[model samples]
Target: MNEPQAIAGVPLRWVGPLRIGGNVATAEVEVPLATYETPLWPSVGRGAKISMLVERGIVATLVDERMTRSVLVTAGDAQTAYLAALEVDARLDELREVVRACGRFTELIGFRHEVTGNLLFLRFEFSTGDASGHNMATLAADALLTRILETIPGISYGSISGNYCTDKKATAINGILGRGKNVVTEILVPREVVRDVLHTSARAIAELNVRKNLIGTLLAGGIRSANAHYANMLLGFYLATGQDAANIIEGSQGVTVAEDRDGDLYFSCTLPNLIVGTVGNGKGLDFVEENLRRLGCREAREPGENARRLAVVAAATVLCGELSLLAAQTNPGELMRAHVQLERKNATTKLGG
Candidate 1:
């Protein structure tokens, strides 16, 4: 065995002149994805082409955004814990001041708590600008914990992260309360487009989505998710753009809604936990920084704006791939055939590209 230092390279390709229309951004932009699934490029490209043909091409709306960190403390008993929780709730203004003292781009958005026996879990949420709020929320939580211990008596510190923050885990709380950028991407495909581009009817895709995505997932005990391979697209985009790729664990917890509107097809993906940022630890690499810059996430803008745009684009990318995959599955053998075809090329090729 030999210890060596080198950067790992994955096959990268820019897919989609994806047309996006929404509050955050409106443009036809090229998206870069790095993955071994070569079929994904064309799959997403098919959806992107449909986007351009449609009217409201991938209407990506950024609904809500926040980063959370929870701290655990102990009290004498449940009664003592209840009183202390209320007391802390009353002095939220004071806690905000504590956060302001240390954080410039992070804003305290208040908190929620869960008390069990003598243990108290205080989950603090914040609006972290531009950068993902993992480190930033932890830093502010550290300051808040000190003030809390000093002000409120009989409450002792347990751990800074009580797992209530639920970072990178596929918990239902993050799906409901949201841990990162919450983006919903949708596109309306005309009957002709569905027939021409997808070679399937809106009825077929919508029925397949219900039977396979919803019921099949429920049968398999999937939590807060109803989609095909959201992780595949998230990983490709995250790896290409320098995100904490593990966040996809929770980020993949999303829903795919499909409906046949008379004859047209309305498809949407609601991703509540899209944990990505333009400026972060992994973003400093030469290729990563360049990719971010090219993706228009590196521009000078208002705090949190760049990250929001990035999140919107990322959500739209997921939609493109998800829509394509689901549509392909409407017809039997298309999905596996395409995957085998592409993977065979990747295997035979010299570089696994």
Candidate 2:
């Protein structure tokens, strides 16, 4: 497949190209950085400018990685639930062994139990190698459940997924326990860069974040999240990279924080439920494979490392888009004008062709 051309007047650069995660033998992957111009009035084009800064190493991003999955098991009665909990704790070592035996890279991290009168729900968390671990977690949960039933008795099979895993929905659980790759992407934009490039001050941006993202979201009844349009960039990137786009529902649940550090802007996006993986379903398509290969996620020493790298890149891209859109909002009429101009240009070009 051909390499991606420039978009939104921003040049594309391959950033990082660095060796990430465990093991030194894995191939070094570079994330593709492109300029993105927001559709807003006044048209600041902060997206493209932020891309340039990321490519030039002016902004630093750190990735906290994990490949997690949760499974739910229900018990018939409270007494049964209590007994099952005791057995589960007693066989923790054996359960880990069962998980290891089931897959080379699957590890049982931890488990939680909740009881509502007679019903008991157990959520098992796992670290599946290189994969998003949805399927892996389910399979491991099945085996473990079977073992528990045989040993404990009086407990019936609840479901492969009890919704306690909280797959595609926005909930407080995923934010607290964390699903997929929990990534926090931040950039420290210089005071001069903020004014000249972003066309706004750090204080303006921070105050807007407080008023719009935090307070506005609270007033609007946002559930455990305060961010503007995280799904925009995430959906585009996920589609290009072969991720399950529906995961964007929970993936969009994140917080955008802007701080005025002296005169500079410290902007970050914390995405807790970014369910992404390098190798899994939908990743085998030719275009998807090409994208992963280009992004340096196709090769890694371990199973989960590549997925972690992909998560970091995805988070960083979201941050760039968020910064651009927020900056555009700082100027009156800029957002709507840019949209009209860009959309009209596209329509005109199409009609001309």
Q: State the lDDT at 26 in candidate 1.
A: 90
Best candidate according to lDDT: 1
What is the RMSD, in Å, between candidate 2 and the native fold over all Cα? Answer: 5.7
Local accuracy of candidate 1 as per-residue lDDT tens digits, 1-353: 55438887889999989899999999888999999878989998998899989877999999999999999999999988888899899999999988988778888996999999999999999998999889999999999999999999889999999999899887889998999999999888999999999989999999999999999999999989999999999999999999999999999999999999998999999999999899877888889999988889989899999999999999999999999998899888998999898888878886745
* lDDT of the candidates, in the order given: 0.92, 0.71
**TM-scores for the candidates:** 0.97, 0.85
List candidate 1 stretches off by more than 4 Å: 1-4, 351-353
lDDT of 2 by residue, 1-353 (tens): 76457422333334433322222122334455433432421221245355455423223233343444444455667887777777788889989998888898789888877766666677788887777777888888888877876787767666666677778888888888787777776667788888887888999999999999999999999877999888877766777677787899889999999999999888888898888888778787676788788876776466676777778777766776788888878989977877888878867876995
